[model samples]
Target: MAVRAGLPRITARVHLDLLQSEDGRRTAAELTRRLKVSPASVSVAVNYLVRHGYVRRERDPQQRRDVYVIDDEAWYRSVVLSARQTLETARAALASAEGAGPDDLVGQRMARTGAFLERISLDLLESADRWRMLLK
Candidate 1:
């Protein structure tokens, strides 16, 4: 499944999908049982998901374990994050090339790329804002 999705790990792919499902909000033990993976594997994959802002972990008041949650806007957040990352990277590249001649191919390309990413990021952010307002 992960391979077909171009994802690096099966655990990550499954974990994310699971979090979006009705059976999500599970503890590590639950994920282990559901995913049929080792506890350590689930832990590592869940950690990765948390790091990427793809999933959130919340303490379950009645239990010692934490619940893993995937927000309804998780995918929307991911898209905006990707756009922001691209824009930031492009800006960094252009900034680094600031000392170069304007006619320099590398600098020119960097500037163009930065502008393109900036536009894309802005559009995505606007769309996200609209979605939020509409969802409210």
Candidate 2:
């Protein structure tokens, strides 16, 4: 499911494992051991997840290690991030269409694409809000 959403296979697996964890959090070592992958591989996957707002890294001060977490808010954050990115792309497409001129067939196509993306982005943003409310 995470892979279909654009995560790499290993990263998706790591995310699924974390989601199934009792506390929605796991240490890097635990992830490596559970997934039967190298520590480096776990690290890379978690790093990618963190960067993309799917996970957060917290310092386990007592254990002197990092714990990766995917809390309820993670989904909301990810959706917002994705929506914003899509909206930015839509804006760029629309601008490009304007630069291409009104009579250009390619420009018309670009305009339509931009409108579609903009609508999808707005819908995602609205859905995220509704889901967030339900989660709370």
Q: What's the lDDT for all of these models?
A: 0.75, 0.90
The alpha-carbon lDDT assigned to residue 47 of candidate 2 equals: 89
Candidate 1 per-residue lDDT, tens place, 1-136, comes to 6557665584565566665678557777778877788888888888877777777899988877788887666777777888788778868877856756588998888778777777878888888877875523
Per-prediction TM-score, please?
A: 0.79, 0.90
Best by lDDT: 2
CA shift of 98, model 1, Å: 3.2
Give, for candidate 2, the lowest lDDT window spanning 10 residues: 127-136
Q: Candidate 2, after superposition: displacement of residue 91 in Å?
A: 0.9
What would the C-alpha RMSD of candidate 1 be, to one decimal place?
A: 2.6
Off by over 4 Å in 2: none
- Residues 86-114, candidate 2, lDDT per residue (tens digit)? 99999999998999977999999999999
- Alpha-carbon lDDT of model 2: 0.90
